[model samples]
Structures are given as C-alpha cells and as structure tokens.
Target chain A: MSDTPAGGGAGTRRRGRPPRTESADTRDRILVAAREEFSEHGYEKTSVRGIAKAAGVDSALVHHYFGTKEQIFEAAIAVAFAPTLNAPAAIADGPLDGVGERLTRFIFGIWENPTTRKPLLAIVRSAVNNETAAAVFRRLVAAQLLRRLAEQLGHPDGELRAELAAAQLVGCAMLRYVIKLEPLASADLEQIVARIAPVVQGHLTGP
Target chain B: MSDTPAGGGAGTRRRGRPPRTESADTRDRILVAAREEFSEHGYEKTSVRGIAKAAGVDSALVHHYFGTKEQIFEAAIAVAFAPTLNAPAAIADGPLDGVGERLTRFIFGIWENPTTRKPLLAIVRSAVNNETAAAVFRRLVAAQLLRRLAEQLGHPDGELRAELAAAQLVGCAMLRYVIKLEPLASADLEQIVARIAPVVQGHLTGP
Candidate 1:
C-alpha cells in the first residue's frame, strides 16, 4: 500500500543516460519479485503494488511492464517453464526410439534445478486449488508444450497420447518434488529417467 | 455454536433403548457432512462446529466422534481411497500381465464415481497448497498404498519405481480431473487404460 519505489531510481538513472528500451535488468527484477510474491501469498492475495515494492520499482512501472495481475502471473509461468517451453523442438531432434528418454530428461532436468524449481513448486501448489492459476498453467502446457508435440506425431489420438505423456511427467513431478512422497522424493535422477522413459516413449509413439 | 442432535437420536433409539455401539448411520452422516464442509471451505476454514451444523449435530458430537479435525480429515482420505488402498490385492486377483490395466481401471474407477470424486477432489486440491492436508494425504498414499505396493515388488529401486508408477497415474488424474485439461478430460476410459496401463506395468514389473 505504501507508494514505495522498487529501486532508488537513482541506481536506474545514476548515469543520467537514457536507453532505447526499458532496462531488461529492471524487468527481470520485477518478474522475480512477482514470482516470489505469488508463490508465497498465492494469486489472489498478491498485488502488483506489493510486487513493485518488493522489486524496488514504482507500481506504475510494474503496471507498464505487465498490464494486469493475470498477465504478470502468465509471465511467471512462462518464466518457470521457459527452459522446457520448446520441449517439442528438443524432443523432435531426438529419434522416436529414445523420444521418451529425451523428453523425460528434458522436463525433469528443468525441475531438478533449484533456480527454476521454486516458482514451479509454488505455481503447481497454487494451481492445484485455484482455477485462474490452473487456467494459465493449463494454457501454457496445452498450447506451448503438449499440443505442439502432439501435432508432430502422425498418430491417432495424438492429442490424448500427448496429454497422457504430459500427465505421466506432470504426475512424477507432483509426487517427487511437490508432494515429496518417499523413495521417489529421494530417488536418483538417472534411475527415474531409466524407468519413466519407456512409458513416455509409449505415449508418444504408441497407437 | 448451536446444540443439535444428529438424526434426532430417534432412529438409533426408536425402542427407547441404548445401543451397544455408536450408531453406524450417525457416524456415516457426520462423515458426509465433514466431506462437504472440508471440500467447500478447506481444512483450516472448516471447523467442528460448522461440520456438526451441516450434519445437524452438536459440535461436541463431532469432537466426540472424530477427536480432531485432523482425525476427521484422515478418515475422509481413507474413505476416498478405499477402492484403491488394497489395489495390490485387487490387481492380484487378475493376471500379472494385465496388472496395469487393473490398477489404472481401479484408480480411475474410484475417480469416476461422483460420490467419492467430490471429497477426493477437495483433498487433492487442498493438499496441493496446504501442507497439513498434504501430509495427511501423503501418509495415506505412502503408508497404505504406494509403499505397500513397493514392498511386494521386491525389485531394485522398488519403492522409487512404485512411486514413479504412481506419479504417472496421479499426474494423469491431476490433469484429467483436477486441472481438467481437455482431450484428456473427454478421452474414453478404455483408451486411457490402454495407453497408461503399460507405463504402470512397466514401473511395477520392470527394472
């Protein structure tokens, strides 16, 4: 609620030099702040002003960069899944025989990173109960990842197959990272990839 | 805050005689009431009094029957997963080769039931964001189901394998039911079973 600035404004303009576009660093800071806020307080309780304050920028700047809370949330999801958003392309480069392994490795690889896991865990946790958050998460997965992959597969029920594949991976992530269910939570990475790859391969290549 | 008796205590003592045990009908009524209250308001917001009111009983009766909200929540999870808790046995009754189909069919069967699905969804949704609910839900899955299944597998990384298998099915359920991701949401039952059963079987029987 306070009209606080994210940065001192002095730091952003200390050189008194104008850049052609908004500083990427500033925008990045806002995104990071938004992610933290949304993860902690959830979608409903988080406010742009709160995010701006945490980001050390004015609320107007947050507004200018991301129009609405929904927009900011979408951006957060995009950032969280950024590494794997183009997973279809990554899996395509791989042979069909090992597509499951490649896809499993790629998706889990992003999830294994501490840097990305935090926001993702938060989003997954929130999306479980909140429809709006789920919608954004669903849109990204269906549009950017799964459906894109499904289109490339010239098979019957490709969409359903693609989703089943996604479901397996999503479920694994849910249990391993989000729920931290025993054994799976502490299982070695290569071990999981070894077991799950074939299932994914089946979903991708199977009729 | 209101003092109310469940079922007017009339059905239990129509002959004006005390019963040997708590009325099964009364206990069942409270459970149904608890499920609705917890689903709608979530764990923290749901109170004994509220549940009692919904069941048309006194808050003291809720406490007398269930001890605490946590206990009641645990009962709810148990009831929701009853069909699948002994899934190993259910699957065992069938051929090992078709175990995946049996398992998948069993879990989805429970999920498809409207009576069970409502409370299960609430618990699953609540568990995502709420640690306490998650813990209760987790305990039931780990101890009663997945871990039990793992113990019987007697394979290398058996527990992890069991969980990965669970992740596949759970993830599918989350997307199809909880998140309601489409194509998946509308996909035919046998089709999904055909696709997912192999993955589940692979996890169970594979190395």
Candidate 2:
C-alpha cells in the first residue's frame, strides 16, 4: 500500500532510470518472498500486498507480473519443483526396465536434500491446508510433471498410471517427512528405492 | 458451566440420577464433541475445555475419562478408524493372494461411504495441520492398524511393507477426497480398487 510517489508511479524502480520491464532480480525476489509468506502464513492468509512488501515491490507490480493469487501460487510451486520436473525427460531416455528405480531415487533424492525439501515442504503444507491451494498445486503437478511422466509410460490409462506412481511417492514423503513416522522415516534411502521401485514399476507398467 | 448438582461435579447428569460410571451415552457424546472440536479448530488450537463444553460435561470429567489432550485425540481417532482397524484381522483370515483386493476394497469402501468418511477426513485434516497431531496419528495408525496388518503379512520388514501400502492409499485419498483431483477424484470406486490392488499386493507379497 505504498504511495505512488510525488510524480506518481515508479516507486519500485530506480529514481533516475527510465521505466522498464521488471528485472529478473526483482522477479526472483517476489518468488522468494511468496514462498516465505506461503510457508509462514499459509495460502489462505497470504496476500499479494504481503508478498510485494516483503519483496520491496508494489502490489501493482506483483499483479502485473503474476496476474492472480492462483497464478502466483502456480508460479511459486513451479519454481519449487523445477528440479523435479526435469527428471522425467532424463528418466525417459533411460531403459524402461530401470525406470521405477531411477524415478524413485530421483524423487526421494530431491527430498533428502534440505535445499529442495524446504520449499517443497512449504508448498505441501500450504496445499494441504486449503482446497484452493490444493487445486492450484494439483494443476501444476499434473501439467508440469505427472502428465509428462504419463506420456512417457505409454499406457492406455497413462494419466491414472502416472498419478498412481505419484501417489506412492507423495504418500512416502508425507509419512517420512511431514509425519515423520518411524521405520519408514528412518529407512535408508537406497533401501526405500529398492522396496518402492517395484510398486512404482507395477503402477506404471503392470498388467 | 452448569452448577455442580449441589455436590459439585455431576452437572452432565440429571439431579437424583446418582451418577454411575459415566453412561455409554455420555461417553459417546464426549467422543463426538471431541471429534467436532478437533475438526473445526484443528489440533493446535482445540482445547479440552472446548470439548467438555461442547459435550455439556465439566472439563474435569473429560480429563478423568480421557486423561490428557493427546490421549483424547487418540481416543477420538481410534473411534474414527475402528472399522479400519478391524480389517487386518478379517483380511488376514482370507487367502494371502486376495489380501490386496480385499484391503483396497475395504479401505476405499469406507471412504466411499459418507458415514465413515466424515470422521476420517477430520482425523486426516487435523493430523496434516499440526506436528503434534501427526505424531499422535502416526502412533495410533502404527499401533492399531499397520502393525496388525504387518504381523499377518509375515514379512521380516512387515512394518515397513504395511506402512508402504498405507502410504499409497493415504496419498490416493488425499488426492481424490481431499484435493478432489479430476479423473482420480471422479473415478469409480471399483475401478480404483482394481487398479491399485495389484500394487498393494506387490508391496506385501513381492520379493
């Protein structure tokens, strides 16, 4: 809710410079601020104004760049899962025999790292708390990741097959990370891959 | 708070009823109240006093019957999952090969029904919202359901296997029921059972 200025507008831009498209740095700041806000206050309580203030931009700029709360949420989750979304392309190049092991390892490996895990935890917690957020998150996951993976699998029921595989991984993440249930929580990563790979394989390629 | 019936502490009972060990009706009322309070306020903000007030019983009686808030939470969830907890025994009695179909059908059947689903949704939402609630939920699920299911499976890592199976179902539920993702959400119950049963069977009985 900052004022435009004495001359009106250009509040977030430099004083002497001509107005221009938002800088990449500025865009990154907004996304980071949005992640923190969504994590701290959850999806329902967070606002564009809050994200803008946190990023040192105006709400108008946030709106201009991201359009709506749902758009911003989708953008935020896309960034968070960017690393994850890259995997299916790489994994598809691999032989189908090891697809399950590679896929499981790839997903859980991302989760085992604190850097990727933190943003993901934020996205999941927000999504779980609100249906609107869940819908947004669901859209991003299906479009960006699961659908692509499904296409690679080449099943008649490819999307459902992809989703079932995803459901297994999502459930493991909830149990191991979010809920921190013992046994599964403390099980070795490689061991988890060994155990869960076949189930994922069966989901994707089973009769 | 109601005046304590002259002797202080039998307000939930009618005067001259000479209070026995809390009637079944009173116990059921308290359980129902606890479920509602936990559902509406979530685990962190819900209070014993709130539950007692909702049930029209004194806080002391709630404490006396259920002990602490955690215990009460467990009791509340136990009631919610009572039907589920019974499934392991029944399924174990059947041929091991049919275990997956029976288990999947049994679980999704409960979810397909509104009567059992309402309480379960409450428990899942509460658990998802708070770590304390998650931990409590983890313990109850492990102790009551997964362990029994695992014991019957006769795998060395039976607990992990059982948890892995639960994780897939839990994830599917979150997506279909909680997130209301399309296709999966609107998918037929028997179709889901048919699709997912083999993976569950693989998890339990596979090498």
Clashes per candidate (backbone, < 3 Å):
4, 0
Q: Kindly list the per-residue Cα lDDT of model 1 for residues B149-201, writing each as its tens digit.
A: 77777776777777888888899889988888989998888878878888888
What is the lDDT of every predicted structure here?
Answer: 0.81, 0.83
Cα interface RMSD of each candidate: 1.2, 1.2
TM-score of 2: 0.84
Chain A TM-score, each candidate: 0.85, 0.86
Highest lDDT, which number? 2
Which ten-residue region of model 2 chain A has the weakest summed lDDT? A1-10
**Candidate 1 off by > 4 Å:** A1-28, A56-65, B1-29, B56-61, B151-157
For candidate 2, the docking band is medium
Q: lDDT tens string, model 2, A1-207? A: 222233347656566665544365578789999988887777877999999999999999999888998889889888988888987886887788888888898889889998999888878877777778888878878787888888888887888888888889989998999888879999998888887888788888888
Query: Which numbered prediction scores highest in DockQ against the true structure?
Result: 1
Query: What digit string (tens of lDDT, one per residue) describes model 2 on residues B1-207?
Result: 233334356546667655444355577789999998987777777899999999999999899889999889989988888988888976877799999888888888888898899888888877876777888888888888888899898999999988888888888888888777666888888788887888788778877
